[model samples]
Target: MNKKTKFITIGIIAIFSFTSLFIFSFIFFPNLQTSINSSNDNGRTLQEEVSNITIIIDYSGVKDNEIYSNITLINFNTTVYHAILNCSEIKVQDYG
Candidate 1:
């Protein structure tokens, strides 16, 4: 094989070897994997629970004519997913 073709083949083999090792490590080391308690209200992982939240905000109420050029307008909407807190290992305090 030519020098260029040999180099390309070696590069591909190196990438595949590294990827296989990474995936094998995760499978062999169970503790290295991140896991959440399955006893939560929804039997989903933390990432899955967080991804289920949907929040929408409307900024159309703020008109450009009402604000000065020097002023900066910022708006946001907050959403709390109670499902994430329903885990058996979590404890919530009420200040009120």
Candidate 2:
């Protein structure tokens, strides 16, 4: 065969090999496709829920420490600042 024909044959073989391997992997391991699609199982989305929260506030110069317990929060936009604000036992100070 000519050099050009040999190169084309090799390219076709390489592509076919890769395609076959890709198809066989899905056929043999079905879960591989699920994992590739998403990290969650059975195509279910992850949910974020926070409850029974507790916070301990201890200052370096102060002797009396504060403990905030049983603070249930049910907001999707709960952040560190929001969680601190949700607790009424502690006082919030805004410097800005």
Candidate 3:
């Protein structure tokens, strides 16, 4: 082939390759986004969902010290699953 044809062929091939990559990314973008955004997931964040709570009473009456009664512990297992399911279902339903 002539130099011009070879250059044109190479250019076309390059363009097609670029376009193919772009289209492929487009097709796989949601999954990729899911994986990437999943790694840095905002969904699995430490939200304030209290699961188990315990209150402590000090008979010594230490008013100067903070009481453990005010402390609250949250377990994410139940809430995370429910929240994830909710968001996934909402996304599937195309809801904002």
- Highest lDDT: give the candidate number: 2
- Scored against the true structure, residue 4 in model 1 reaches a CA lDDT of 100
Whichever of 2 and 3 has more TM-score, that candidate is 2
Off by over 4 Å in 3: 35-44, 47-96
Ranking by lDDT: 2, 3, 1
What residue runs in model 1 are displaced by over 4 Å at the alpha carbon?
32-96
Q: Candidate 1: lDDT over CA atoms?
A: 0.49
Compared with the true structure, what per-residue lDDT tens digits does model 3 show for residues 1-96?
899999999999999999999888887674564643455556455555654433333447555432332233445444534544433333445567
Residue 2 error for model 3, in Å? 1.5
Clashes (N, CA, C under 3 Å) per candidate: 0, 0, 0
- When summed lDDT is taken over every stretch of 10 residues in candidate 1, the lowest stretch is 68-77
The TM-score of predicted model 1 comes to 0.30
- Residue 37 of model 3, lDDT score: 42
Candidate 3 local lDDT, residue 31: 58
**lDDT per residue, candidate 1, 3-96, as tens digits?**
9999999999999999989888877775764446646655453332223343333347684322212222122212243432332134678999
Residue 27 miss distance in model 3 (angstroms)? 2.4
